[model samples]
Target: MSSNVGTSDSASIYRRSRRQPLAITSAVIGTTLEWFDYSVYAAVAAWIATEFFPSENSHVSLLSALAVFGVGFFFRPLGALFFGHMGDRKGRKHALAATIILMGASSLLIAVAPNYTSVGLLAPVLLVVARCAQGFSAGGEFAGGAAFLIEGAPEKRRGTYGAIHYMAIIFGNLLGAAIVASLIAVLSGDQMKLWGWRIPFLIGACAALVGLFLRARSTDTPIMQQAIMAGEIPDSPISETFRDMWKLVLRGVGLVCGFTIVTYAYVNMQSYIPAVTGLSAGTAQWLYSLSLAVQIPLIGFFGFLSDKVGRKPLMLAGAVLLTVCPIPVFALVATGSTPLVLLALIIVSVSIAVYAGPFTAAITELMPRRTRYTALSVSYGLAAALFGGTAGYVVTWLRFYTASPNAPAIYAAIAAALTLITVISTPETVHRDISK
Candidate 1:
């Protein structure tokens, strides 16, 4: 009878162990769906803006549209603080589920908003409001997902699990790009500008609902639950994170410089280039989507390598390569040849993935369990806003002033340099036990 009892208990434990992997998979998928929902707006901005904004000057319209893109970043830190606090104080599973709901609601709102033709200034205002809500919800989604997977996975496989989260991000980007590309392929320009542009957002909103449902079923990490039970959890996570781990936050900002620029180039600038630099929008969309699809496998490969080679070396190499490569890379893209542009995009994408693939593990490992969500959120949100969110605006503003196309490269170079500082300061985190 005792033997049977022990066997039953062991089976239960094995079942839980199995559940953890599925939970992490859900977490990754949830985050990807959420971010992909946010990103599709930027991917289809030029078309959406023309349809909705109806400005006489294309450059001014694109700039206004992209400015609205940055507007979301402004709210991210606030969302990070609010949701990060909830994650640390409540649980990762709960916070993530809530964020998905908020994200989905905002996306749905955007999909159904009226155009300027129907509502005048109210159209843009509503768009900003929806984006702000999304920014706030997304602020904590990635950080929570990172911390959850890191804490839940076995120590030896933390890098692999953590990499899944980033894989989801790249996957989301590809999904968004593919959705937009497919629409463009079928629709005429007038049709796309008028109505087809909203389809991706509608799809994203639906995906977010699926993610929310999956997140509802995910279990909380054992470490977090134990901390709560032991009363070791802080009453106020944001204050505690700031007081205890400001250094880590600074390092996060520095690290984000590299991460953000790479993401900006791949996601934001892919669409921006055609609008601003005279590249064909159709060709740019296809190449960007194609390059991203090819790069996804490479991200997984590099992420696995990060565990063996150590996160620091890969990050350092990414920083160095980005610092030197941005100017020449952007110059080549400006030439308007689809082949050359695709080649340059892929090269930069591969170089950036070396760091991005491991960043979730590296950054989350730096903060203690007590403050992991808040610390990661603050670090990622602020850095992303400063560098990544503002990339298109700053680059365009620079181009407008200097009448030079080289300005975006300069922005990329500066951002990469900040990442170099982060690599110097950040220690390797692979295999670190979060329970400590």
Candidate 2:
């Protein structure tokens, strides 16, 4: 009897150890690929503007392209509704697998899309449709991926595990920036505008294939499995979430607001820097990529720290810094010096990383497992659609209207203030049992 018991225990331990790494990889790689696809669009936004929205007035063309970028975000909430329902009703693995395939197809579609010169209005329309598809896929990626990690993680280390999702996101952005920088370095201005922009989208499509394979092979989280066996999955997760968990949903929106604003502003600033400071696009992209690379380690460190020190303190501090530092950082970028611009980006990246590092765990812990995915997806999707998707457009429009380079910073500060309020009001969720 004792030998059989020991054998069973050993087998269970071995299986768990093996499964954990694969789950982590699936979560990270899948999210990374989706983010990479999305970031590619922003990284090459300048080239895309010229190619797809050719106009006598460059500003008008750029604004039109950005508006389309924002348009994609409007569809995210709908995606959340659909995918969130799937995740809650079917399983996390199923939802994640489906999202990856959808995102991959959309990215591939963008690679083959005709430019405005070739197809007239249909060109931008196709681009809009592709972006919306990507938005829909992304709507569920973060929440579902985070929920998967959180549910699988040991209670004490959920923060550390959850941080991997954000790390993947930064890595994805870094990869996108690197691709854009490489193209800019290798291609002439005309070459890049004509054909180079499509290369990143193609790369994104290929990477998505890899993510899809990994996610498809991965097993569902144990918590999700238990729910399935018990037949405890909610029939109407969206309605249930809104009915019982509205406060948690509101809190999620508030916490996500600053993150969306800061992240989008940081990304959009890469394009904005070259426009205002007269730096080469290659330099701006390289600096942006380097900044993101530096933040990856810092994000990991903070994620581990959140497990020890608590999520709220780090998040609150980050919110305070974001509220205070945007103006100074933008001033440094305006100097047009490579080193100063790099420094400015580093400062902003660090602040954002601090908050982002703990965000996934903190938000996921706020609700019960039954509606966790839906609640987080809906709130995050709404926040992103409202602020993140519109960030580049809003900043550009603000700068255009006010004729001030500081407009983006001012916008970030306002968003940060709202997040600060939310952080102050919400309790720390680091110790909560997600399985409840």
Candidate 3:
């Protein structure tokens, strides 16, 4: 009887070990698909402008398209509120599954949306509605996914596991860039403007369907299960989080503001480079994609390093470098040399990875378990909406107003300085026990 019991216990343990990786894979797939959907709009914004926001002045059309893109971000905080409550009250698995479905549906809607030429004013109106839906789903997907991964991970490996959440983001961006580049390579510019833009959105919808299937098979994390069994789940997580954990939420905003600014600048640069430098659009896309690909392994390296040294030190180092490096890097990019531009992008990507890799784990540790999903979603969603969503539009307007090629670099530097202040004030959380 004792031998039989031991054998059964060993088999159960093995089964659990197998399940853990599947859980992580589900998180990765969901995050990747969400970001992929978001980025497709960005990747094809120029084409979207011509097809959906026609204007005599090309610049006016581009600005209008970007404005619509920014508008989507405004809905994120609302999504966070609704979905965060679901995750806290029901389960992370349930919230994530719902988010993936919403995102997939929105992307499909965008793919099939009629052009302005066909539907007139209603076309742009429909596009805005779909983008807002995507923004809402994304508001929950990231923070909810982060909380899921962090809770499921081994106590000591939280940083490394949380890093994967971000890695999926980078991978998703890379995928979008690659798809855009390939389309550009094969299609004439006129063809792209006519219909090529819709293809990426279609691809994004299909990818999201695959992600939803994977997520459906996964279970809630052990920490969430424990909370449910103990009846520790909050009745109103958003209200409870703000009422008691307001300070932590403020700190999260401060920490995220600079990261959002830097990241969006990097994302918009793919479009910026070709417009300003007269580089081949395909070449520019390839270079940006390559930089992101290289940064993935570097991100993992930094995440592992944080477990040994600490999250704060790596983050602080990154903040300082970002504050100081942008002016010089942008100068190199202005030279318009392919080699110089590639080098500058690579350096900036490395700095971004250093701080971003450990960010999710650190923040997860800071908030209490019961209200973590809601608090994190609210804080991150707000910062991303206010800073990240507006970055491309703001930078373009600054460049136009100042008539200076270096305006974006100055903006990044200021954002980085503000982040450095937050890093100094925030305590290290890598060693904290998150389950408490």
Candidate 4:
């Protein structure tokens, strides 16, 4: 968040803006770009080790790369504080624009970064700087983007709009997986090690430019506009977040923890742990993308359904499924039977859709509009930093010591079971008026 201390004119455009489609576009494109940054970076972690962290041996280099990757997660909470404050005080529009631009710039830097051989230690340093920027930008993107989209929606349609953000995440993941799979199929190992990895980052950079255009042209959400006119913006959102909204922040963190751990840790089964599925790499990636595609319409449908039935039931059902389903899903995946593996992925995606549909609206609605952006960002950032950031490492560490392939699934279940308790205690927010 900028401390330049200038008044923002972000609310000015909302009155003239009747085009909600543009607001939706701005949200989807910007979010897709932010998530695509993570997807591609995770896919290329090994190659990144060779390019920027040529230390000790291949194993050590890969670990170093992974460490750098995890380093980005630590910066997320910082970004949340910075951009959340910006969104609350400067207006959501300014925060949205700044985040997209920073993300785009970071992607561009990574795309053209020098290899260790060419620039010595400076190469890895540059990589870290870029990754940190990415993490910081992501920290605020989701909370701000969700608040922005939901604020612009019709009362009956907030869930549907919120679901678009989740759809964009899936789309971003699929896009990254597809592109990386395509390049790996076309390029030789040496080619991929040398220059092939840059292609995806370049494409991500280009996508961010599109996000900037959409956000720049769009207005702030109407709810945010009203908050501005009513003089409800906070002077110190961080203080308020810890003081008055502490309970809501805890609820927000619990709701987000299991959801992100599962989404980030396991939807990536084929990419990171392909042997678990016992399928050819290309075949697994394609089927994985296809199976997850099932979540798209289901998310939209469930979102609309939540608007009718209320958010708690759907979230409770999803949490129940997430707690119990991962073990069985991975059990099916381990069989090496292609059909069973595909079915398993679909089952999990549906569970995700069930949770994903209403979680954003339910969580955001927990806070008053004045502190919604900051509080949401802080809680979510903390969850990502704590659970999401450590998910892969914890799963891998457990699998190594326990000699059980079910480690990741078990980890997901335990975290989700925790979330189930939180959701059960939370009130239904569908009928609440958020503009206050």
Q: Which one wins on lDDT?
A: 2
Query: Given candidate 3, what's the lDDT at residue 5?
Result: 100
- For all candidates, what are the clash counts? 0, 0, 0, 1
lDDT of 1 by residue, 64-163 (tens): 8888888888888998999899999999988898888888888888889999988998999999999898888878888999988988877766767777
**lDDT order of candidates, best first?**
2, 3, 4, 1
CA lDDT of each prediction against the hidden true structure = 0.81, 0.88, 0.86, 0.82
Lowest lDDT sum, 10 consecutive residues, model 3, at 34-43
Off by over 4 Å in 4: 1-18, 53-61, 275-280
- Tens digits of per-residue lDDT, candidate 2, 213-253, equal 88888999999999999999999999998999898888999
Best by TM-score: 2
In candidate 1 the C-alpha lDDT for residue 211 amounts to 79
Per-residue lDDT tens digits of candidate 3, residues 181-210?
A: 999999999999888888988988888888
What is the descending TM-score order? 2, 3, 1, 4
lDDT of 3: 0.86
Error of 1 at 420 (Å): 0.9
TM-score of each: 0.95, 0.98, 0.97, 0.91
Model 1: runs farther than 4 Å from truth? 1-13, 276-278
Comparing 2 with 4 on lDDT, the higher-scoring candidate is 2
